[model samples]
Target chain A: MAKALLLNPTAFEAGLVAAARARALSPAQSAALEAFSKTGLPHRRIEAWKWTDIRANLRDDLSSASAANDVIAPSIFGGLGAFEITIMNGAAEWSGEAPAGVTISCTPQGGPLSELASNHPLANLAFLNTDETIAINVAEGASVEKPLLIRRIAGGGAIHQRVTVKVGACSKVTIIESFDGVGRYFSNSVTEFSIESGASVERLVLQNGSDDGVETALCAVAAETMSKFHQTALLLGARIVRIESRIALGGEDAQADLRSASMLCGMRHADVTSQIDHRAKGCTTRQLHKSALKDKADGVFQGKFLVARGAQKTDARMSVNALLLSDFAEARHKPELEIYADDVECAHGSTVGALDDAALFYIKSRGLDDAAARALLTEAFLGEAFDAMPHPAIERTFRTRIARWLEAGK
Target chain B: MLKIEDLHVAVGGHEILKGLSLEVPAGEVHAVMGPNGSGKSTLSFTLAGREDYEVTAGDVTLEGENLLQLAANERAAKGVFLSFQNPMEIPGVATMNFIRTALNAQRKTRGEEEVSAADFLKLIREKGKLVGLSDEKLKRPFNVGFSGGEKKRMEMLQLALFQPRFVIMDETDSGLDIDALKMVGEVVNSLRAPDRGFLVITHYQRLLDYIKPDRVHILAAGRIVKSGGPELAAELEKSGYDQFIKAA
Candidate 1:
């Protein structure tokens, strides 16, 4: 009998380790990486990874990293005049000088290294091997009028990246993270945000990956008293992609709203998993996820709300809706609510269905052919997820991406 | 003009309209009275090109063009409208938007220009008032959370809006009160033109009292068993469909 050998780490982990060593990672960071290396990449054996086999896709041992050849065009958010930071092949590049009231540094202290090492084994391995982390901090009581855009571009070999955002007390800020890449490379990323009391932060994450690339993003957010945290994510599917968001409401009256829309075509796969924990009383959380899957694509949404015993009067609601365009397309939804407080109100609902025939007939009767009618209805359905976004620019960008996806799919 | 010759329809392998036939020339109103399960609704659904109802052996034509050869929306574009007995409530579809889309689709299919947004808004508002639907009702999702009477009024509003060449009202009076019934009569009376025709299917004669029919027929076992003038409706109301149910 030939024994199966788990001979090599994924290309992403190897590249990340080389990048970290070149940056001369600290002893603590090195130790964290060593611990992460033991577990390696998550495979189909893991319950959460059963649907998307990231390990299978990451089997190749990547070569040494080089500068990606493709030039990244301006972001869809270019008209917003955002403060832009570009990361090419896991290295950070600033367009110009950093803006006032905001400090940007290269460090590994405040990101999701510990969280990744403790919770997700694969993310821990990526963090262990990754080099520098982009640290962004907003000054106390500072109001950022413009959005801070972080663009991550990867090509050829694998890459690992990390980002940390800290919003000081009473400050307001918005951050937009856009991930685009080429070639067959693996990209692993972790983003951690610490929102102080009375602070408000808005975040938008856009991931559009190549057919051969595998991407994973782990986001951990901690919110303080009276703080507000809102995040909207749009994903154009990859060979295999998973985005995990973990939000902890640590202060009274803190609120968190998370919304995501995903469009997947061909044989691509996309999964969005989120967990919201309420540790204090009077905290509220609202989550909505919408996905449109076509061809043989698969989309997954898993959301959980955990309210501690003393977190009384906690209100949390989650809804996940999916539209399957083709008969071969698949969608899986798991919404769970764990509430220990007797006074809390928690509810969750999930639905997966094809477009309504009656509605199609009605739309077609009005003037649209089958294709036009289907596209219009689909856009309207997914548009509901981003309808409540506070920033018009962010909402419009998301809408444009959705339209582009529909148009391209056609 | 619309014509049905030797129409035979079967649903779920069971025959409904067996050799039934009727004709309505332009500028005429024909009423069909039948007992429950006498295939009244099935006839309307078949005429509207619903998928489930099968025409085993029949022929229907509108202005000398084959109606069954066209798709449902195509039939709509060809000026065939059926005011459903139970109007479907589609969540997330705006009432005014759906109406405008359907109207423009019909117009576009017939090589006409699309209705501008401002023009559509004004037209719907005017027609909505004529059908007793307030502006607030039109702003809501299509028929969502609407009362029975309001849903019927919505159907009337569509009728007044589309003004299709051939209109089939299947049990439109089933759920309406006197006021709603009067509203339906007013819509039909307004849309009565030299080039338009109507087929009103009802169980009660009260509706005919509001909008007088040129001819009335009694349907039994999927076939027209008797035909007469306006007095037939009064006679059916006086004596019930008990005799036809036994004969059918």
Candidate 2:
């Protein structure tokens, strides 16, 4: 018998590995786990994990996963009349039946796993080790009137989950994903979206993790001809949070709109990264990100647009703006564009500054005290990201989140 | 209604307003004219309480109250308004919303009731017409995409709405055509009252031809070098401030 090796193994890691091994695993999956035992989890020493010290965050040694019976309170979106699905400790539970024209099932195969298995090590590990995948499919020409809500809750140990969504031709739907937790845990999630030709999908992601929890999410989307994909993400704060998006405009006349707003305070860290590829002609992509950092927090934003050859008439633009409220807070931004087509219109800009003195004075000269003036200005700054959202309910929810954060700061 | 006694100011270590003194009684319009590089703008901004414009000496008072002891917003609530020469264009702020908020804020500070939306709408419409600004202009972001003349018109509109007891017009007619200038004059003449005063700062005599100031003072090297009646404006316009500039 080969003895198990520990590489900076925390109690949490040991418990997660034991639970995963007890659940079933193929020979190849067992071999991959053995390989992971040798190298252990990646640390800040590695090039890609320099800013986020995952190994240090997992220093505690945990033994068992939190019980499944631990109930979570209602979500902030509870009043939106959405069809709610709860995933507790990586297990999906549907309280109500699926809406008409929509089907839900459990699929272990057939997803983005095959496409991304070899490119990214983390994706491969997550696909091979996760218990199951929840699949949602919409029939062709079907329109879903109500939004779908997916809530993920985790505690005590590490949990990885995946979601696959497919929208048929000419279909329309809206999906919202909320990540929340209260204990010391790590949640790694992946969501794959496929939009068929002439389909439209609007997606919103809300991440408000506990101070001790760490969350990382990856979203990969494929767009067909004349299809549209819009995504807006709002993150309050986390110990180490990262959200990555990779979108491919696979057909002509496809369009994508990506926007995000983040508020980081204390010692929290948040990163929003995106890469958009224009592979077809006459495709358009627009991206905007805004961050507000106070105290000793840190924010990171990196965006890139890649236009391939023969992709003429490609219109793309990206901008990132950040506001720093204290001397110790920091903001890092990088906007890149790699264009090979001669007739493309591509541009990127980034700015980091303190609040404007003139505007502050103007607002204060009204009757608002200094604090109220600051809150109002900060809201106006971040509110621009949700300008294009069609649903007023979701927009108002995001605005309320901003207001809550400001109140907590005070 | 407003008084400045030996107000000395400096910017970047250069003294701009050295021992400058002036007084505006209730219901009076005072014009300060001088050559280039005079300290007229400095006086207006300092009174409006802009940061970094150091007040090295003396004091400013309004209605026997020490204006120098208050912040910019406090002074504004005390009925002091400055119509900037070049108004700032805030990209995402709505013009109508900002105006209403500012008005309500001032009222709230003075223990007055908040203005209703219907009342605000009616007031803006009336004031917009008096200032020659169309309804479409009020729908845009605060001053965004507006020309210099249009920006001046916005200032006039704010003046008509706030109705402050003391108003400082800093080169309010810099880029206006004859029609716009006439409209500005009409707004000022309509707002005139026995309890309110106006300080119109200008570089030309044409605007003075419409508003008709009671006294025109020459500011040179941060201090007043000459004071005269309305004819003094035409004299300086024709002969220029060559004598005043040399004397300062």
Which residue pairs collide, candidate 2? A11-A61, A11-A62, A12-A62
lDDT of 2 by residue, B142-162 (tens): 898999999999989999999
Candidate 2 global TM-score: 0.92
**Residue A260 accuracy (lDDT) in model 1:** 94
The C-alpha TM-scores of every prediction are 0.91, 0.92
Clashing pairs in 1: A16-A129, A17-A129, A366-B101, A366-B102, A366-B105, A367-B105
Candidate 2 positional error at B189, Å: 1.1
lDDT tens per residue, model 1, A217-329? 88889899999999999999788888889888989999999999889999889999988999999999989999999999989998999999999999999999999999999
lDDT of 1 at A390: 83
Model 1: fraction of the reference interface contacts it also forms: 0.28
